[model samples]
Target: MPVESLPLFPLHAVLLPGAALGLRVFEPRYLDLVRECGRAGHGFGVCLIIDGEEVGAVASAAAFGTEAVIEDFNTGDDGLLTLQVRGRRRFHVHKVRVRDNGLQVADVSWCEADPVEPLQPEHGLLATLLHEVIDKVGGEHSKAPESHFDDAAWVGWRLAEMLPLENAQRQVLLQTGDPHQRLQQVLALLPE
Candidate 1:
């Protein structure tokens, strides 16, 4: 469905619906954006500008990202805001409508999920290796399951965004329309 024009905040991170992301609002423009949302009962988009000269300088120029809703917010002594947001949905940005007083507005469209081929048996190896990586990282809630690999989209989004991959690689994953393709790209990142 077509979404109303919304403010955009393109970052290097990807946040899925129901996922929690902490944001430190320091930039004047972004602080204004947050305040506007708080007043308007609306949320902003957090997109990553994969191919842009200036990120956060303006809104419309930012790349695709997920819709996010503020969960908790507090203004600090420095006049900065410490806020937590929950991602709501994925959306494609069309254009920026406003950029003033440290705030930006943009036209956006919601993106639908693309179908993907079922994970093949060999994909289990990729899952196993990822489990090891998670174990190495430690402190995460739990290890990746050793078996039962399925649902390419959930796996792809979860792993692509969660893995310690660089922003460029994560951008590639976000750009792809196919879930299996995203999973395959991430699998390629593993050692042979």
Candidate 2:
């Protein structure tokens, strides 16, 4: 399929397909993006900044990311927006064209998932750490069956949902095509 240009938000986060992300939007440009998205019922891409000056690469740049849809939304009295986003598919960024409103128009193509395989040992360890954290946080997710991590996609999605990492970090995992790599990174960050 031909790549589409999306309004880009270059944060330090990563979002994976089937994972959820939340945002609080106050910037005027993004406010427009959100409003347009809501009005058109079209989803936008969420890309990881990877590495770069947030302001320096506002235009004619690229960010690795995935397509996502806003699942829940609430508007605050202050005119700020709080919305929940869920990753739908992965995409490799080609370039972002700058607009007058400070939002980047990203050119990206959908990245198809590779064949499924078993999770690495580190991935399993990350799942354990996630469960431990859930236990400590008093989250009901810990009650899920032990077999939840058996599927690679399930493990990645579950970890993305359960981990306490910031939005930027989570976005990286979502953009990564290799579920094992995402798992390894999450494992590396597992609470000491």
Candidate 3:
């Protein structure tokens, strides 16, 4: 396992690998985090908040998290920073240190990359469901390449995000190490 210290952005949300997250930055601590990441050419860690809120105080967060890299940034009409970020990889936090400015810096071990597994015949329904979701929701996912629909990991992540699963459920999916196993988990979560 590769270990490194990263700026942690603990939120009430879960960011899965390959998922895109849009964020509005106004908090000073997170603003500092964005700036630091921009300067260092690395992204910050996003974990589900286990306790406390998004703003003020360093909240207790889940041990497993995803590394988010900035994809785009600009100032919104309201003057706050708007950012587009994409989840890169999963990690597990070993230790956390709070800065004087209240940003939580975590020493995390990066997990192995998810393998590219083709969608199995049993999970074809899941890929079909994801396609239906894209047709209805029609956002970034609508633009995803056709290859994504055939990928077990991509199909599972999209389904996990599109479904009405709780944050904890999303975290569980993120922590699932195998791509094919993730599809199995998603299958069990669907309405029968």
Q: What is the lDDT of residue 103 in candidate 3?
A: 90
In model 3, the Cα lDDT at residue 42 comes to 98
Off by over 4 Å in 1: 1-3, 12-19, 50-61, 75-79, 114-118, 138-149
lDDT of 2 at 27: 74
Per-residue alpha-carbon lDDT of model 3 for 1-192, expressed as tens digits? 667999999889999888889999999999999999999999999999999999877799999999999999999999999999999989999999999999999999999987788999999998888899899899888999999899888898889888999999899999999988889988898887
Deviation of model 2 at 110, angstroms: 0.9
Question: lDDT for every model?
Answer: 0.68, 0.70, 0.92
By lDDT, rank the candidates, best first.
3, 2, 1
Ranking by TM-score: 3, 1, 2
**Alpha-carbon TM-score of each model against the true structure:** 0.75, 0.72, 0.95
Point to the candidate with the largest TM-score: 3
Clashes of each: 2, 10, 0
Candidate 1 local lDDT, residue 110:
78
Error of 2 at 129 (Å): 3.2
Q: Choose 1 or 2, whichever is better by TM-score.
A: 1
Candidate 1, residues 1-192, lDDT tens digits: the string is 666788877665666644578887877778778878889999998876555433345433345777899989887778768888987767777766665463557788877765545666656666565566556665432444533346576566667656778766766676677777777888888657
Off by over 4 Å in 2: 50-62, 114-123, 138-147, 160-175, 184-192
